[model samples]
Target: MAKTVVQEFTKGLWAEIPPFRLVLGLCPTLAVTKSVDGGIGMGIATTFVLVCSNILISLLRNVIPKQVRIACFIVIIATFVTVVELLMQAFTYALFLQLGIFIPLIVVNCILLGRAEAFAFKNKLISSLADGLGIGIGYTLALAALAALREILGNGTFYNIPIFGPSFQPFTFMVQAPGAFICLGLMLAGMNMLGKK
Candidate 1:
């Protein structure tokens, strides 16, 4: 009846996916998903912060006082978020520009702090690693799926490759804010459908 380390990891992929299955971290998810590249960029950046913060928090769990633990977690999470921002700026400047402020804003993402307080603070090193990775990948996949749909519908392109023929008309609105909300809503509905099956 005990869960394996792999189960702890894999659960984040579908069972407890954030911004969708778990309904956590919707801000950046909707903010940067206009294009597959930007969405993936934000996803990886968040994943980096998530995994690094989770590992560090798990390691320091016993050392941190319960009263001040949230502050410590934020400091730790912010440190990694800064690292991700710098790496994105240096290595992926274009995607960096596309994502803009959302990169640094990852520090406030609830999913990172939620995992730190709820899971990493109480779990072992490997289990925390799996949980972070699973959650990160789940978030990345969700962003990529949404971005793909938005790009294809709004721009008639997949990663700017032009998926639909020239005759296809792009629904430019699909890449806008209203489109983000609509896409997110539809995606959640799809997840619900899948969950019911």
Candidate 2:
């Protein structure tokens, strides 16, 4: 029983990673991944909201009316998102600027809502916490990886620190809109191939 719970907690680290295997919450994944800084900031913010909302939702799972459950979940999620937004804006103005609309948009992030409805709503508080943390970490890692790729290849830097030297010619397009889609798609393909192996 204890081992099973640990498995549930660890699954989201790779197996059910968001915007990769699960394919939820792509908006922030794509929007804030241009820079590693923005990616890390946004990822942590989303994780904070996700974990908070999941805990609340799991605790209130039975009290919430069936008809109004979605509304309740939204309220809980929005409340946490607001907290994250204000904290980010107050402490990390530059990253907040980079994340911009995506911060508030966390209220509607599918991963948060989906877990609230599908997992948290049905699980114990401990299980829900594990799920939220695992999924949140997965989301964060995905964003960071994508941001690192774009930052290194597209901008010739890692975390805004020069990496490739003066001779490196950045791809430039890797940071563009089309490039985001292409990069994510390629990554998804790579993941699929690895999963099959």
Clashing pairs in 2: none
Q: Candidate 1 at 85: error in angstroms?
A: 0.9
Error of 2 at 120 (Å): 0.5
Q: How do the predictions measure up, each by TM-score? A: 0.97, 0.98
Expressed as tens digits, the lDDT of each residue in 137-193 for candidate 1 is 999999999999999899999988987777998999999999999999999999999
For each candidate in turn, give its C-alpha RMSD to the true structure in angstroms: 1.3, 0.8
Report the lDDT of model 1 for residue 100. Answer: 85
RMSD, model 1, all Cα superposed?
1.3
Whole-model lDDT, candidate 2?
Answer: 0.90
Predicted candidate 2 versus true structure: per-residue lDDT over 1-197, tens digit per residue: 68867877798898999989999999888888888998898889988998899899899988999899999999999999889888877889888888889999999999999999999999988888889999999899999999998888899999999998799999999998777888899899999999999
TM-score of 2: 0.98
